[model samples]
Target: MATVIHPTAIVEPGAQLGADCEIMAYAVVTKHCVLGDRVAVHPFAVIGGDPQYLKFDRASATGVTVGAGTVLREHVTINRSIYPGKATAIGENCFFMSGSHAAHDCEVGNHVVLANAALLAGHVGVGDHTFFGGGAAVHQFCRIGESVMVAGHASITRDVPHFTMVAERDDVIGFNAVGLRRRGFARAAIAELKTAFHEVYFTPGNIRDVAAARRAAGAFDSAEAKRFLDFFAGGKRGFARARRAEAEAGE
Candidate 1:
């Protein structure tokens, strides 16, 4: 399996290419950039450009690396690390759709999908199997946990927890039920998670205090419950409160 580089592509010296990798027309793979086996760079995709960090000096510019089987769509821009001589990485099997941008030092995990126009700010960390819908934007330094689904056009400024479905302005309405089911969570486990959600967000008590108490009491007794609690607890910008109708109905 020979690597394929389009005639118009510019792959700089010292940029390593793996077997079966494809660099399309007009794409640029800059110095020290490494593309793993079967990686696909679509036309106009830009990889390994210098960091956009204001504090970074040209002499200390770092590089970018893409892992095996990843696909970078047309016009996608992935920048290098801000720290001198370091590398920013995109994990294996991930998909970056057209026009998406990953800023300097961002860490994207394996199997994650970034939809068209989704943007990840510098130093953001996106966990494996997460999906960022079209036009979603993550703030700098935020952490998005594994298997989460961020709804289209949502603006995320805070950390999003694993296995959650967040939508409509910081509202974590529920667990990622479809994702959980696909990942083999049993019916009992799902039911327990639902109960935890009710208690944490829908009940009459103060959300933070109630969540803390539930955590202390070990209520629900599952890894999902703990993860949910931990996410809410660690929130610097607090989670959204349940809707008025939902809160009233839960009473």
Candidate 2:
């Protein structure tokens, strides 16, 4: 299938458009951008724009790579990376709703959904199959885990664990129970995650310490639980916490 670019769309020289890509009216695909097969860039959407950072050099060799079948809605903007030899990448089959933005150097995994006006700050890492509600805002460099659901307008400042639901105050409110069910996760798997959440996140102590104790006690019984444990162990932004009596007591 031939790629279609509307007459009003500006696909600059050196931009790579894969087979069957549809670049709509007034959309801009910058010179360094690469769009994979069947990508639909809606009207007024902009891809591979210059980084917003002050220190970024315009002459630096960097761009955006949008994976196959991704849809960029109207007015959505995905910026290129800030450094040379880098690219801000969006994974395959993701749906970016209108007015959403993914900032420079961010890496978003496949099948993620960013609702209208959801925003990800620079260098944020998002895992697969996560859903960000409308107007939810992630702080710069935060890591969001897979299968997570961020509630609308929530403020996320720290790393969110897999299959978790983040709501008010950026707290890890609970497991993404409805999402898990909708995704056909086994009943046992969902139960295991709930137990892990209580032990690792809701325990009235230092979350890491509680996670360690659960590991020592073999409290994590399933492979899903093990992955949950590993996420916290390797997390960079640290885990999001709710108001806990133990933490307040120590303070």
Candidate 3:
């Protein structure tokens, strides 16, 4: 299929668009941008805009790359990286709702969904199959694990673990059981994840010590459990935890 660019849209010279791309009215695909096959840029969306950094050079040769089958809705803005040869990357089959923003140097993974007005700060790394609720905001340099669900209006300043569901208050409520089910995770795997979740997040001892002990004991039975344990090892901003008061209330 041929690429389609509306007469009203401005695709700057040096932008590389693959087959079947659709650029709608008033959308801008700036120079150095690369859009893969079937990518859609809706009206008023802006791709490959300059980085919003004080130290960024205007002459930098950085760019943005959107993988195949992604959709950027109306009013969405995705900024390019700051340094030469770098890029702000969005993976295949992702969806960015209207008004969503991906700041400079973000690494978004495949099948991720960013709802309307969701914002990702510079250098954020989001894993595959994650869901960001409407108005959710992730702080710079944060890492969000795969299959996680962030509730609407949440402010995420730390790393979120895989298969978790975070509430609006930045608390990890529990595993994303429904998402796991929908994704066809085996029942036994889900059960193992549940047990590991309780041990890592809700154990009585010092959280770090408990996690270490569990790791040392070879207590994790599944690959998913091991992955969960590995996540805590590199938590620079720490991990999101259950709010004790809130959990008590819910119980």
Candidate 4:
């Protein structure tokens, strides 16, 4: 299939576009930018522009690279690196909805979906198959794990674990049961995840205490349980704690 570029679009020299790409009107593909096969650049979307870094040097060359089959919707802005010569990348099969923004130096993984108005700060790392709901924002340098689902309007200042459903401000309500179900997780697996979830959040003891109990009680043997534990253990900004009021009310 032939690539299609609107008359009003400007694809700068040295930009590499793969087969079947479509660059819509008013879209700009800057120098050194690379777009993979079947990538779609919607109207008014800007790719491979100068980074928004304060220390950016105009003389230095840098660019953005979009992976295969990725779609950049209308009004999306993806910036390139600012540090002399570097690259900001979006992985294969990713989708950025309208008005979404991916700042410089960020790495987005395969099959990730950023809903409309979702914003990623500079240097953030989004894991594969993750889904960010509309208006969700991740702080700079935050790491989001695979298969995670962030609720709409959620503000994440820290790392989010794999397969978790996080919502509200500073709280992880529960596992992503619905997401897992849709992804074909078995009933036994969901049951194990539920048990691990209770141990991690609803237990009477601290996180460490609950983790230790899980290990001793054979809960850590399951793959899902292991992921849950390892995620919290590796947390830098610390995972959200269960609400004290809810815990007390349950008691």
Candidate 5:
């Protein structure tokens, strides 16, 4: 299939566009941008802009790469990485709704959805199948896990574990049960995840230490449970804590 670039759109020299890409009117794909097959850049969207860093050198030969089948809507901006040969990468089949922004050096995984006005700060890492609701904003360098749901207008300042739901101010409400179901997770797996979630969050001292101990003790059998536990192993920003009242009520 042929790629289409609107007459008014600007795809600068050195930009790489795969087949079937549609660059809408007034969209700007800079020289360092690379877009994969079937990628759609909506009107007024900008990719490969320089990083927002104060100390960034404009001469850094960085890039922004959008993977296959990704849709970047109007007014969306994905900034290039700050280091040479590095890229701000958006993975395959991801959707960024209008006005969403992904700052410099972000590593976004496949099948992610960023709703309107959702913002990912510089150097943030997001795992696959995650959903950020409208107006949600993740802090810089935070690691958000796979299949997590970040509620609308939430301010996430810490790492969120896999399959959890975060809302308001860094509050981990609970496991993302509905999302797990929609993703075709087995009932047994969901149940195991629930147990692991409770054990790790409720009985926790230092959350990372608790999760590591549980993992070492072989307390969880299911892959879902293991993944949930493993997520706590890293991230310097610390994990989002579950609300005490909600945890007490077992919500």
Candidate 6:
């Protein structure tokens, strides 16, 4: 299938668009962008714009790469990276809703969804299959884990572990059990994850230390549980902590 660009849309010289991409009216794909097959840029969306850094060089040769089957809805903005030869990358089949923004050098993974007005700050790393609720905002350099659910308008300033649901300002409320079930995770795997989650979050110790000790002990058998424990290895920002009172309230 051929790529389609509305007459009013601007695909600047040197922009590379793959087959079946549809750039809607007034959308802009700058020369710094490389859009993959079947990517859709809705009306007024902007891709591959310059990084928002104040001290940045305007002549930098950075880029933005949108993976295949991604969709950028109206007014969504994806900025190019600041470092030369680097890119603000979005993985395959991701969706950025209207007014969502991905700042420069973000590494967004496959099947992620950023709801309307959600904002990802520069250098943030998002794992695959995550969902950010509308108006949610993540601080720069935070690493959000896969299959996590961030509630609407939440302010996240730290790393979020896999399979968790966060809400109300950096609170890891509970496991995203419903999401795990929908994703076809085995019941046994889910059970292991739940156990690991309790040990890592509810334990009476430092978050990283608890996770490391549990991982070192070979306590968890399932890969999912290990992955959850392994996420505590290294990060600049601390991991989001579970709010025990809130967690128990729902139980």
Largest lDDT belongs to which candidate? Answer: 6
- Count: clashes, candidate 2: 0
State the displacement of the C-alpha of residue 189, model 6, in Å, after optimal TM-score superposition. Answer: 0.6
Off by over 4 Å in 1: 203-213, 232-251
Between candidates 3 and 5, which one is better according to TM-score? Answer: 5
Error of 3 at 19 (Å): 1.3
Superposition-based RMSD of candidate 4 using all C-alpha atoms, in angstroms:
3.3
List where candidate 4 sits over 4 angstroms from the true fold. Answer: 204-218, 244-251
Each candidate's TM vs. the true structure?
Answer: 0.86, 0.92, 0.94, 0.85, 0.97, 0.98
lDDT (Cα, tens digit) per residue for candidate 6, span 86-127? 999999999999999999999999999999999999999999
Q: Lowest-lDDT window of 10 residues in candidate 1? A: 242-251
lDDT over C-alpha atoms for residue 72 of model 4? 96
Candidate 6 regions exceeding 4 Å error are 248-251
For 1-251, candidate 3 gives per-residue lDDT tens digits of 68999999999999999999999999999997999999999999999999899999989899999999999999999999997999999999999999999999999999999999999999999989999999999999899998999999999998898888887756887778789889998888888887887778778876667777887899978887777777777757877888655543432
Q: Tell me the tens digit of each residue's lDDT in model 4 across 40-63.
A: 999999998888888888778887
Error of 6 at 128 (Å): 0.8
Task: State each candidate's clash count.
Answer: 0, 0, 0, 0, 0, 0
1 against 2, candidate with superior lDDT: 2
TM-score, prediction 4? 0.85
For candidate 1, what is the TM-score?
Answer: 0.86
What are the runs in model 5 whose C-alpha is more than 4 Å off? 247-251
Model 1 lDDT tens row, 1-251: 68999999999998998899999999988875888999999999989887787887877758888999999999999999988768888999999999999999998899999999999999888888899999999888888887888889988887776666776666665567788788788888777777786777666777778888898998877887787777667645445444645333432
Question: Model 2, residue 231: displacement in angstroms?
Answer: 1.2
Q: Please tell me which model should have the higher TM-score, number 2 or number 4.
A: 2
User: What tens digits encode model 2's per-residue C-alpha lDDT throughout 1-251?
Assistant: 78999999999999999999999999999998999999999999999999899988999999999999999999999999998999999999999999999999999999999999999999999999999999999999898998998889999999988888887667777677788888888889888887787667666877777777787788767887777777776656777875544322321
Give candidate 3's TM-score. 0.94
For model 3, the superposed segments whose C-alpha errors exceed 4 Å read 205-209, 244-251
- Residue 220 in candidate 2 has what lDDT? 62
In order, candidate lDDTs are 0.83, 0.88, 0.89, 0.82, 0.94, 0.95
